[model samples]
Target: MPDQAERLRELVRHWELRRKQTRRTIAVASGKGGVGKTNLTVNLALALKEEGRSVTLLDADLGLANVDVVLGIPTTYTLAHVTRQEKNWQK
Candidate 1:
């Protein structure tokens, strides 16, 4: 049986092949707080980027956008702005 790293590599390879046809989304969530969801999401995005894939990490938490805090990126706009059509989501 393949190890954890090997399984992840295989999954990445599968995604890489499908990436040319369409985009993908991965969500990290937990019903409880302080469960390291943000940490895992950030690290997973970074790892995917390191593997030569384009990744966009979107934090949908309207109240506390913790992903921005974890990444040390000050967000001037969020999904709310995008929903209102005031900001482009791709930007």
Candidate 2:
């Protein structure tokens, strides 16, 4: 069991190293709403993209999703749709 655990730890460390070399990830979160968390996230993504960094913004706020609205992009699908199998994320 200990050997297996050590192997898992080594695998995790290897993947973590690869992940750091690949790209950066940022998560903007706040316990309170209407505090501009979404706004900041969108702006940060735009700034990163402007600097030639690839950016993919995910609006995880299912209850009060406003990232698309703030960015002036209409959403035909959401995480809920994906969860319900109504839409495929790859599409």
- Top lDDT prediction, candidate number: 1
- Relative to the true structure, candidate 1 reaches a TM of 0.72
For each candidate, the alpha-carbon lDDT, in order, equals 0.86, 0.86
| Alpha-carbon lDDT of model 1 | 0.86
Model 1 regions more than 4 Å off: 1-21
Model 2 steric clash pairs: none
Kindly list the per-residue Cα lDDT of model 1 for residues 1-91, writing each as its tens digit: 7899999999999997787668788988888888888889999999999988889989887777788888888878888999899999876
Clashes of 1: 0
- Residue 49 deviation, candidate 1, in Å? 0.3
